[model samples]
Target: MSNPYAPPDPASRPPKQREHTGPDAPSPADGGPGPGKAPGRQGRAGRPERPKPTPEQLASVSRSVLHFGLFMLAAVLTMQVDLPWHLMSLAFAIGAVVVGVRALVRVFKEQIRGGIVVLLVFGLMLSGMLVVTTLGSLAVWNEQMERQECLRSAITVSAQDRCERIYQEAIEDRFGTIPGG
Candidate 1:
């Protein structure tokens, strides 16, 4: 019975070459790590061990997180509240620029992957959502205010009821009609 784990015939096996042996042993010739060379003595696949990033990369990554956070906050506020669209857009733009610049600088300095472009693309996509949300919120607020103005001039209960229904219908048309209404 053949031993599955056994080396295929010792005579057929190439003799094990010791580290740094004969003239055929690797040298820095031809601009590459030659055969039989372990780039880091114990590193896998003869690859030189990677060095850890400097404090510069760490600091820049932190700043990028902060800028991204600002963009998220602005996006939420613009969508939920009645704030001016321009103000929110300005905040979003600044956040995108700051984060992108920091990530790009780090990319060039450190030569890393998934840098500036990813963050910028995310920011722009959310910025577009913010615009749509702001328009929706503005329509809701306007409808409410118009109802209030109409009710103020209304002399009877029926007039006030009519004013409320008109505003409600207008809001429902712009958005979808509320469930259970």
Candidate 2:
């Protein structure tokens, strides 16, 4: 009887080869490099480098910058307007708290230097906003006070004039003072 336990003959066995081809081939450095070249040199050359800064990324950056610039401009305009000092301070404090929290989160994520830079920038922005708002509020308050004082003075003068006229009429009626006619 034939040897039942013997291994199959090499000539009769299927050729050793990968099942797939083309782009399906693994990269040279990682695995079998098929379609184009030998596995050793496939990833080393011939492939075009990827383009930098995709359009979406560029647009995102532009939008972020525009938003930041607008925010800064608004803050500057607020400085010229009448904002309350206490309210401004409160808003700045809130902003600072938010920035601190974000920075802490970044730090926890192993971005310590980035967190510090962000914290510094946010702190500066908050401070600037507070100052602008505070100054605006003070200016508005002063203007209101001046207007009130002017109104008060005008009322006082009018009241005094009316009092003088009434007193004159009473004297004329009491003493029959039509002598000038």
Candidate 3:
């Protein structure tokens, strides 16, 4: 009448293999909770635990974070076409590249496994931002300077408005119609 698939009765098991009876006892598959079990380690076999990262390795990973932050800042700044924004974006992009280089060096020297690929991606992004911002600024340098000067000297709303119109004309002349309509 007993089910054949049911587990064998613990009472009939050998003394060493008997499942311990307690709320805190582990399952039989885990070798139970008693002298039969190896404490402080799992019975399941697989890869051994990995070693903790040294301070230098951790610092290498941290550099990636700094690189990512600088890259993000540069990306945001690059969206603006103004002269100062272009300069600032270029600066941030350069800083990101420097940080990425340091991160890569540390990763190689310390033999860390992660963060290198991400740093390379960030490096490419920063490079693109740098090139775009630099070329864009160079292309509009004179017009940007004139617009900045006019805005700086203008004291009235009408003069400030006139500065915008002049800037529009300058841009139109440079690129044959301003972008974004």
Q: Report how far residue 52 has shifted in candidate 2, in Å.
A: 2.2
The C-alpha lDDT values of all candidates are 0.64, 0.51, 0.69
Candidate 2: which pairs clash? 83-137
List, residue by residue over 101-181, the lDDT tens digit for candidate 1.
555566556655464557655765665566565555555776866776798799999999999889879888888888898
Cα lDDT for residue 40, model 1?
42
| Candidate 2 per-residue C-alpha lDDT over 101-133 given as tens digits, one digit per residue, 9 for 90 to 100 | 444454444323444456457755665556565
TM-score of 2: 0.28
Question: What's the CA RMSD for each of the models?
Answer: 12.8, 20.6, 13.0
Q: In model 3, where do residues sit more than 4 Å from their true spots?
A: 1-52, 67-92, 101-127, 178-180
- In order of appearance, the predictions have TM-scores of 0.43, 0.28, 0.50
Model with the higher TM-score, candidate 1 or 2: 1
Q: State the weakest 10-residue window (summed lDDT) of model 1.
A: 78-87
Location of the lowest summed lDDT over 10 successive residues in candidate 2: 106-115
Top model number, TM-score: 3
Point to the candidate with the largest lDDT.
Answer: 3
Give residue 3's error in model 2 in angstroms.
70
